[model samples]
Each structure stands twice: as structure tokens, then as C-alpha cells.
Target: MPDDDATPRAPRPALADAVHEIERHVAGGGWDGPVRVFALVRTAAALDADPGLADRLPAEAVAAARADAAHLTSVEQEGLPQASSLEDLLARLSWPQTVDGVALVVERVVLPSAAEAAMPADPEEALAYLMAHPDRQDVRIAVGVLRDGGSWCAVRARANDDDAAVAGGADLVPGLVAALATTLE
Candidate 1:
């Protein structure tokens, strides 16, 4: 006997898959340097692909995705920001809900002695020098975030022993994380 009154089930939320990908990425010390990662998703596509998410998603967000399909991009193909530029990069980006989530794997810059010597005392000049000398840097802290407002961070300091400290070290980039979170909002 067929159950005509029953509604069909929605697909799994696409966010689950994306979060899983993040988990896998960080599982094996894979993240080594500063990288700004974003998951630019089309709300329509996400819903079509994972209808289960509709129950939790707001109408406005879905509308925004439909309206801005042109701006949507796949993270798989586009890849993360591959440089160590720690400038106010987030200031330049303000994505709508249709754009999905963004994650950042950032590292505190440690300059080589020679490069540090060459850098000017002026902050502006130092920024310019660092921008031109990407080769002379090493990154240590890595943070990841999801559109649903979940966040994670990892650290690889020169001599880190306390797990609590490493976990708590996420506080080091609250401003950046806050900025990235707005993209999902």
C-alpha cells in the first residue's frame, strides 16, 4: 500500500558536507600558512542540492542567493587566498547571506632577521615591505568557520605544549573572525 499523505524527505544540509571537508583538512596538520578560505555558495543551488536546509534557512537569505547567483562561486575551483597578506583584507569583503560562509587560516607573521632589519620603523612602510616580501614569512595560527556560525582554530607555535593555550589562542584573531562571520550574516 502506498502512503500518499507522506511528504518526501529533503536532502542532507550542504553545510554538513562543507564542515566535514574542513574537519578533514585540519585533521592531519594540513594547514601550514596564512590562507583566507571562503565557501561562496548559491542559496538556490544549496537548497536544490540539500533541500533539508530549507527548514532552518530564512526566506530572505534564499531570496538573496537567487538574486545574486552571478556572484556565487565554488570553493573547490576558486581555492583559498593563498598569500600571507595580513592587511585589512576582510574590510574589503561584505558578502550577503546568499554568498554562504567564509573561513580564514591565518598565521602571525614571523619575519626573517634580515628582512626585519630592512623593514622601516613606520607601520605603513613596514606593511609595504611585508607585502613585497611574502617569501620571508611563516604563519602559525589557523582558524576555520562555517556559515551556521560555528568556528574552530588551531595553533602551531614554536614550542607549544599546553592544549588549553593552543585552543584558547583563537582569541588572538577575534577581530578577523568577527569580520569573517559577517559575510555569512
Candidate 2:
């Protein structure tokens, strides 16, 4: 059997665009924010279900949906219950059939691999250590996964905080991508 991790999945343009869109939207709010989740839905399907929605959605988005059947719209989820960790939040998530996919935006302070050995065991101390580390990097990661197994990720570093500087790929953040994929399952 082929190793799933080794398999390369073709990039889904619509999903990539949706992930990037969510990343940019979250970036607009600046850093030091709570985790945000979004439900991905096919714009055409959403419109067909309720044509009245067009009046509420952005005009450009609606027009794009009409022009391309693959266009996806990201609907931000609100009032999510607080979880001890992101993994716990993801573990508790399950999507409805209507949701084509899911995306999550989260900001994290990352240090170089060398810093891992020096991290404090206490959660609070670890956070403090990370914050005080001279090499620490603040990054916002947006990961999107479709039910069809397509996934995309967008990463924006605080050091190079520019929309055009954002890095994107299918496996940029593989662990997060897999976690998001399980929500669809």
C-alpha cells in the first residue's frame, strides 16, 4: 500500500484561494488574536439553496461564483467553545454535509528547532520562554482541507508581514492539514 504521507495530492485552486482569502482576512485584524474557524461552502450551492443570500454576500464574490462553479465562500464560525488546545478544538469538530470543507486561522510564536531542547516544562514558563527567545518568530497559519482530500496552507510571518510575501502550498503545515482533514471525516 502507498504511504498516505508520501502521496502528493493535486492542488485545488478554489481551495487554495479560499485558504489565502481566510489568511488575509485574519491578517487584517493584526496579531495576538484567538483562533478563528471558517466553514467552506461552494458559492453556487449556497446561492442555489437561498438566492436571497446574494444580497448579503459581497458582489464580487457572487459574481465570481456565477462565473466559476468551483468558487468557494468562507463563512466564519462564531461562539466556539474554548478548548485547552487547538488539537482538542479540532478533535471536537465535525462538519455537516453541506460544508464542502473547513479552515482554521491561528497565530503562534515559533522558535528554531534548537530552542526545543531548552523549553521549560511548565506551560506558563514555556510560553514565557518562547516570548523571550531572541529567535522566536510570530506567524499566522491558515489551513484549509476539503472533504475530497484536497488541502492548502498559507503562512504569514510577522517579520515579513506582507500579503504578497505569504507562503502557500499543499503541505506547508502538514500536521495542521491532517488535523483539519479529520474534521471532514
Candidate 3:
């Protein structure tokens, strides 16, 4: 006779596949603006995700990452950095070996310097100017990693015209793959 206490679990995604899915979601949403990313990792979980990474990380970094494992769980919605501050925060980060995966959030505008300079100073005029320029760009996207190294993302773009022009994920954010790689490394 079998016992009654059994629960089937959902299958987890492969780390790489999870990353790709996040990219796909962002692309589908036509995200275009600034991007912010965070990595959520566990040393053991990271090793399971990428065995090759075992050789690349320093012991200290791995220890630090493990110690910070609960960081993501404590983050509240208002606790996230403002979109404008994303770049500054990223510049200061140094990923450790215990990092299992990465998370990102972006809000950006892709406009030529000339266009920015040509905008009107008056609020009404600025609104008019923006309405007249269909090519003006603005996008926002958010990506996050699970403790197991799986990832997910959400995106929204301001204008459909500009949205159709940009690619998703790595193509959308420069240095993204490298930044993500740091965690695994």
C-alpha cells in the first residue's frame, strides 16, 4: 500500500532556456528604454546550472554571494532603484561566484542628440513636438532571476514605430550578457 502524502512538482526551466524566455518576453513587449539588472544566485545552484563555472570564481566571492542569498527576498516594490539611477548602481557592482542568475529592469529612450536639442522648452510645445515625432523612443523592461538560475522579464515600449526597430534582450542592452556572465563566472 502507498502512503497518501505525495505532491508532484512543476519542472524547472534550464538556466539558459529561462534567460532566452525572458529575452523573448522583453522583445515581444517592444521594450526600448533604460535597463536595470540584478542577479540572484546560490553557490550550489550556480554550480548545477553551469559546471564549467566552478573553475572561474574566487572562494571569497562565492562566500559573499551565498551570504547575500536572501537579498532578493527582502526587496519591496518601492525598494527598487529608480530607473534614472540604474546606471550608477550597476557601475558599482562586483558579482561573486555564488551568483546563480541575473535579473534586469530597464527604462530608456533612444533619441538622437539633435532631436533632444531641438525639443521645445515649453511644456505644451514639448508635448506637441513629441506628438509630431513618431520616431521618438521610450521603453521599460524588467528581468529577474530565480534562486535556481531561471529568469523572467516584462517590457513595455512607448511608440510602436520605434518598438519595431529595436531587437530584444542583449541586442537591446549593451553589456548585458557580460554582466550576466559575471554571476556565473
Which candidate leads in TM-score?
Answer: 2
lDDT of 3 by residue, 1-185 (tens): 11133221221333333344444545555544335354555555565577765578666545544565332211112244443455555555544555445666566555567887889999899878876775776756545444333334344555653434433332234254334433443
Local error of candidate 2 at residue 9 (angstroms): 1.6
Summarize candidate 2's per-residue lDDT along 1-185 as a digit string, tens digits.
11366554766799999999999989999899999999999999999999999999999999999998889999999988779999999989998999999999999888899897899999999988998999999999999988878889999999999999999999998899888888888
Residue lDDT tens for model 1, 76-165: 324334433454565555556555555555556567787788889999999888878865544455544445454444555434433333
In order of TM-score, best first, we have 2, 1, 3
Ranking by lDDT: 2, 1, 3
- Over 4 Å off in model 2, which ranges? 1-8, 121-124
Q: Give the residue spans of candidate 3 off by over 4 A.
A: 1-16, 20-36, 40-84, 112-134, 141-156, 160-169, 175-185
lDDT of each: 0.51, 0.91, 0.47
- Count backbone overlaps in model 2: 0
lDDT of 1: 0.51
- Number of clashing pairs per prediction, in order: 0, 0, 12
How do all models score by TM-score? Answer: 0.41, 0.92, 0.39
Residue 14 lDDT in candidate 1: 42
